[model samples]
Target: MDMREFAGSSFITVESLRAGPREEVVVSVAPGKYDKPVATFKSGDQLTLNKTNVRTLIKAYGEDSRDWVGCSIELSIGPTKYDGDQIESVVVKPISPPKPLAARTPVPKPPPPKNDMNDDAAAF
Candidate 1:
């Protein structure tokens, strides 16, 4: 059997969502599965973009899906109602700015080598 049998769904699933939010790099965004726009990740999982996901991605990256490639997004499970039943769904966490680098400690230079020759040496 192939991965499809093991994976069940080629798309990301709520049950597969990690305990903590995980960042995934976008590999490509294109029509997949049912001719709907899907965001494929470097992790090899694909997420079919719903209206909420589409809006979130647009707000984070831009209107152009092409620009979304190579960008990162945090995924988590959130509550949603489907068919009058509460269910967990994959939600894209809001994008946050990268933290600034901490100040580096300056390395001290070594003292210059001492002159080995004595001052009494004859001038040539």
Candidate 2:
């Protein structure tokens, strides 16, 4: 895509989780690859760009596990001054599977001893 357009500020499309809080996220401009600094964000964090910047959809998440819900994304670019500033905040709810319910079947109880085979309760 066009990294220049994404230079100012924009949201990232998290694809999968990587090492630490980092995750593989996609950028609107760089549709071919991902970006760098793979760090997570909050509802009001600033995403920055550095020398090791690349166009990749993968990023190292930090604390956006409750926001980026593995779905659509809406990049919000800040002013040109804070283009490469630290991500102020983000609102991404990580999409995760729901907790399991109860078990299907219960364990069966042992059968009682036969009257004739009973050692203690057997009648004469």
Candidate 3:
């Protein structure tokens, strides 16, 4: 049995897409996502780039597919018209700036050591 059969959906989706618009590194470009040339991501999800998506990538990364490898792109679901019907589709967008690290909570300082002298005086 092909182990990849259980690897989940080969195509990326809004629900399956990683949280937020994280940059996805291109693993390879091949024909498979939908019988057409698709970009495979490091996560093993393949995305068939529509014309708009292709243009977006081209504008951001240029035309060379070889150059596309190792490059980052953000995938998100956007409204698109298909056969006169508006449907949600995977779209590629330029990677956004990395979010700033969350603020860390400062560790509380330990309480001052008890003064032995004070205890001795109290006992007197």
lDDT, candidate 2, at 1: 75
lDDT value, residue 17 of candidate 2? 18
Candidate 2: segments with Cα more than 4 A from true spot:
1-69, 80-124
- The global C-alpha lDDT for each of the candidates, from Candidate 1 onward, is 0.72, 0.32, 0.69
Indicate the residue-level lDDT of 41 in model 1. Answer: 83
lDDT of 2 by residue, 74-110 (tens): 3332222236675433222223332222312233467
lDDT string for model 3 (18-101, tens) is 465556888787665455578888777787778788777666665655556777787877888789999877778777332223
Q: Model 2 — TM-score against the truth?
A: 0.17
Error of 2 at 29 (Å): 16
Reference-based TM-score of each model: 0.60, 0.17, 0.60
The 10 consecutive residues of candidate 1 with the worst lDDT sum are 98-107
The alpha-carbon lDDT assigned to residue 112 of candidate 2 equals: 92
Q: Which residue pairs in candidate 3 collide?
A: none
